[model samples]
Each structure stands twice: as structure tokens, then as C-alpha cells.
Target: MSQFDRQSFSLTGKVALITGGASGLGQNYAVALSLYGADVFVVSRTQKGWAETRQRVEENGQRIGFLEQDITAPDCAAAIVQHVIDHFGHLDILVNNAGMQLRNDVLDYQDADWRRVIDLNLNALYYLSHEAAMVMAAQGHGKIINIGSMQSYRAGKNIFPYTASKHAVWGLTKAYADALAPDNIQVNGIAPGYISTDMTRSLQEDPVRGPEIKAHIPSGDWGVPEQLMGPVVFLASQAADYVTGVMLPVDGGYLLR
Candidate 1:
């Protein structure tokens, strides 16, 4: 390994597109990348949290932009990438962080529900990645980060489609990495553990399920959104230039149990 330069972690002059930036981990991701010196473009279903996210990014003295639209719409990826390029003039990082989960037993899960989850979580990501990779290829280099989950490895009680989609995310990461490597674009994933987010708050509050889940984590606790900051900024920077096609778990050793 070559000597590590602290500057390798800087994202100065780069532009990043982060989906689902209206709230949760995506919001933090937008801010974190900007703090490292990257201009950011955020996309979400609504403008609910864009003002706050934009405020945070600008506070770091970085430029920020947002697009309010449902990512599940047809050709949305192409439109989003075009908007970013037209506004920013270039793109360097694509963070496929827009995801949704539906919790229900496999037997009770409806076809519509399954399709909805798959469309937003898996299909939309692939579409955006394909478009982003094209732009990145033209730029001669880029980084793509997919947000996976603990369910990417093991099955969850409910959320069958979510589990399936996340597992497929790992496959997508590898496939894209291989095909885009020659274009100088690196594709990877971050599999976060049971993070404390609005989606998981209910499960964490359940008396029985909550304790059982916590006991399984070797870290003896759940992770917060901020914990993902380092991993994302690392993958987005030069430090991970040689790394690709890997689904890195940010789980608190929950997979061990």
C-alpha cells in the first residue's frame, strides 16, 4: 500500500448526487460529503427536508441543490442525472440511497406491495446507476455507493421484498463494478445494521423484538445515522480508488449471531 495522504480523503471540486436526501441517513450523507468539500445534489419524493439539508451543506461553505420528484417514475434516473449535469456541469459520485421497506409476512404480502418495494429499492437504484455510470464514464472516473442492509445477508421476519432487493443490491454492485471498472468508475455498497431511523423506530420499541435484536448485536446497541458518515466519505474519496465490488457491512456484529 502507498503512504496514506490525508488529502486523499478530500472531495474538493467533486459533485455528488444523493437520493433520499429529504431525511434520515441520506440527509446526513449529503452533509457529510459536502463537509469534505464536494458540491451536492439531492433528490427525494418531496421537499420536506431539503431546506434543512441545503442549509447544512451551505453552512459547510459547499454548494447544494435539490430535485423534488418520485424516483420510481419512469425515466426518472435519466432526468435526474441530466439535471445534475446541466446544473453542476459535471458529476463524480452517485449515492443510490433512496430505499423503502414494507413489513408483512410473506404469506400476507400483496403483489402490489412487493412490486412497490422492488421498484423503489431495487429497480430505481439500477436505473439511476446505469445513467450515472454513463456520465461518470464520460468524466473518466466516479464512485457509486449503494445502500444495502443487514437483510442483504440474512432474512428478516417481515419485509420479504426488502430482503430480496437488498440481496440483489450486492449482486448489482458487483456486476456494475466489473462492467464499469474499465471506465474508471468504482461501484460498492454499505450494508448498515439496525440503525435508529423512523422506519425502524417501531421495531426498536417493541418490548420482545427490541431486546432480542439488541442482544444479538455485539456492539450492544443500535447504530445512529451519523455512524455512516465516515464509511460514505471514505468510499467517495480517493482513499477507496482501488476498492470495488464489495458490500461492506456497517452492522454492529449482528451478522455474527
Candidate 2:
């Protein structure tokens, strides 16, 4: 490959931080970045499943660390960022992948439920990004990858808070990208579509809505968590240095139909 090509893709010696790294999409992202040579720092609410993720990352010969904490807490963002700096000394990438969703009709949505979803999905993400951005600005370069969802652009039933949070996330991504560009910090988002993860198991298995959802996807099937690996890895690497504020959908063309 050419010099530019190599520079764009390689993440050797870089340090990355991923929220929600214990399981699901977060775990996959941690491993994928490790495969590209980034040392990974993972934050999750529980230590469960972290051992497997750590093993997968170390198998690629990259350093990995994990911290168990509730990201929804007000002080969690600062703590997580400090922990990364303490352990790795520097950070090159931060993936805001920790999120929560509540399925309830708008009329039935309780204030507490709405707060719970927004607290993590949007609030925590913003706090974490803010802290990471400060460090990245000081370092003169960094990547911030937020985990948006298809709900970011379109509407879905019984997911009011989640939709609101995701839509806000895209806005935050753009706002941060614009604000941080001068500091060489890039902020972007990934909107995954109909991925086969535990979070979507209930919807995907719904006899009434499942087939309708599959038919809407041009690929005629649901995507697996692994399908997100490439898009995320690219966004987190030097390949996306010039790409910011955009929400790239890894959605099997779901938006087309």
C-alpha cells in the first residue's frame, strides 16, 4: 500500500478507551481496535464478560484494561477518563458506546424511565466526550466515536427516550466536531441498523414486527454484531482523520427502503 494508505489505517501504539466494553457491540469494538494495534481501556457497569473481552484483545498482542463502574453516575466520566490517563498516560481514541433504552409508549413512559435512558445514552456520552476532548486537545489530536442508532434519524414506536437520546447524540457529534476541529480532535458517530445483539433480541423476535423489519432492510436480514467491526475500526483509526461530524450508518441499506 501507499504511504497515505498506511498512515490512514494503522493504529499501532495508539491508546483507545471504550465505554460498555463488557459485552455486545462495545466488546466487539474493543477487540477490533486491538486487532489494529491500539491499546484499549474499557469501562463497563459490571466486570461480567470482561475476561473474555480482555483475552480477545490480548490475543492480538495489544494492551487492555477494564474498570467497572456505573457510567450513568454524575462523576463517572471524570473518573473513567482519569483512570485511562493514569494507566496509559495518554489516549488517542474514545468510543462512547455505553447506552440504555426503555421500551414504552409515549403516553406510558414514566419520568424516571425517561431519565434513566437519557442519563446514560445522552448525558453520560456528553460528559465523557467533554473530558476526553480536553485531554485530546492538550495532546493535539484524538478521535471521539459516539454510538448512534438508526433511531437517530428515523422514528420508532415504544422507544421515545432512546430515540430522543440518539437524535441528540448526532447533534452532539456535529457540535463537538465543529468545536474541536481546531484542536485536531475529531468527533463522529456510527448508526448501526438492526444488529443482532441482546438489546434487539426482543424486537427481532417479534412475530409481527420482525418480518416487516427484515423486509425493510435491503440486505434482507439482520446484521450481526461483527458486521459493525469494520466501520467502527475505520472511524477510530487514522483513516477517519478527515472524517468528522458525520454519522456513518452500517445498516445494510436500511435507510434506502
Candidate 3:
């Protein structure tokens, strides 16, 4: 192969499972991976909105599957993993991107809310990664990309549980990387800054807070979900064979300023 062919980051013949793949960042990750030639399986609670994502992936001539899964359930991870294995016969990449955020101060936060946030953001990721790692270890190669957040390191107002869970995600990424690196499995994180997704649509529409956020970001523009595709595909491809346990900021330099 020539240098150009050798350096291509195509995921041809790989299988990827993305949680929360019906919308937002997860949808973008699924599409990007499929476009690069991977067969993608998208898992989410609702299948109502995935037509666009499915069409896009199929248009790329890649195999696509969707699973309606409430990942908050304790057994959800293992089931999803088994389903993928049964359908695709093997797994090569896992994207833990299913999460939700609610605005509530520490004092007013409810215990149930805390548990819900942690369960989906942290616990579900643990279960899914644990199951996926077993498959990867046996196969001797895989990539686990955990979706972290800017709050993984920094904090904002009124969202204590989300901040805490995101911090835990950072620690989990490193722990998994350390444990799986010897098995030829690379575990990493992508901490995105304020991206333009439905989740952040309300904030983006706010005239007051939106401008304030835009001013702080060096790029002066909120990143789109598509902007995240390149980094994710790189991390999942051969280009990142030696890169693991690092939190890559696809934030348009927001972390710097």
C-alpha cells in the first residue's frame, strides 16, 4: 500500500456499538464511524428519531442496526453486547455516549436524581465497558471511547450531579485504560465543550447566557456535532494505536481559554 492508502483511517470490517445513538453527539459518532466503513449498532431508549441516522449510515453502504434499550437497567449492558455479538459476530469499538443533564443546585438536588444521573452516566458505562472489554480481550484488540464533558474537569452552576458524574467518567476512563492497555485494548475519552445539539439547544437559544458562553469560548462559536466526527474516527482507527488513557478535547480550544 502507498502512504496514502496506508494512512487512511477507514474502519472497514469493524463493528461499533454506540449508546444514545439516536440523537445528539451519539448520532454523529455513529454516522461518522459508518461513513468510515464500520458497521454500526445504535442503542437508545427510543427508536422514534433514528430514521435520519439510519438512512445516512445505510447511504454510505454500511450495515446498520438499532436497539431500543434502556441502558439504566442493571442488565442492559450485557444484553446489548450479546445482541451485537450475535448479529455481527464480533465487536471492535464501543462508544459510551448515553447521558443526561438536569439543572439543580446541590442543596436542592434529589437523591433519586443523583442516582439516575450516576446510573446512566457512570454505572451504565462501567457495565457496557466491562462486557465489551471481555470480548475485546478475547479478540486481543478494541477501542472504547467514553464521552466525557467539559464539566469533567470544570464546574458550572446548578448541575452538581452531572458535574460529579462527569468527573467520575474521567477517572473511569483512566482506570479502564490502565486495566485494558495490556490486553491491546485502548480506552480513551472525548470531552466536548459546548456543542450545538438538542441537549444544548435551549442554552444556545438563551440570549443572555448564550452570548456569555460564546464570549468565553475562544472560537466564539459553539461546535457542531459533525465537528466531533474526525476526532472520534481517529481514536477508533489505527492512527491512535499508541494513544490511550488521554482525554481529547474536541472543543475548538475552549479548554485553553
| Best by the lDDT measure | 1
Better by TM-score, candidate 2 or 1: 1
- Assess candidate 3 and give its TM-score to the true structure: 0.96
lDDT of 3 by residue, 2-80 (tens): 3445556989999999999878788889889998899999899999668998898999899988899899886878899
* 2 against 3, candidate with superior TM-score: 2
- Write candidate 2's Cα lDDT for 212-245 as tens digits: 9999999989999998999888988777778989
Give the clash total for candidate 3.
0
Every candidate's lDDT: 0.93, 0.91, 0.90
lDDT of 1 by residue, 1-257 (tens): 26588899999999999999758999999999999999999999988987899899999999988898899999888999999998899999999999988888768889999999999999999999999999999879999999999988987768899999999999999999999999989999999999998888998999999999999999999999999999999999999999999999998888888
RMSD in Å for candidate 1, one decimal? 1.3
User: Each prediction's Cα RMSD?
Assistant: 1.3, 1.5, 1.7
Q: Worst lDDT window (10 residues) for model 2?
A: 1-10
Clashes of each: 0, 0, 0
lDDT, candidate 3, at 149: 92
Task: In candidate 1, list every pair of residues with a backbone clash.
Answer: none
Q: For candidate 3, what is the lDDT? A: 0.90
Q: Which stretches of candidate 3 lie above 4 Å from their native place?
A: 1-8
- TM-score per candidate, chains pooled: 0.97, 0.97, 0.96
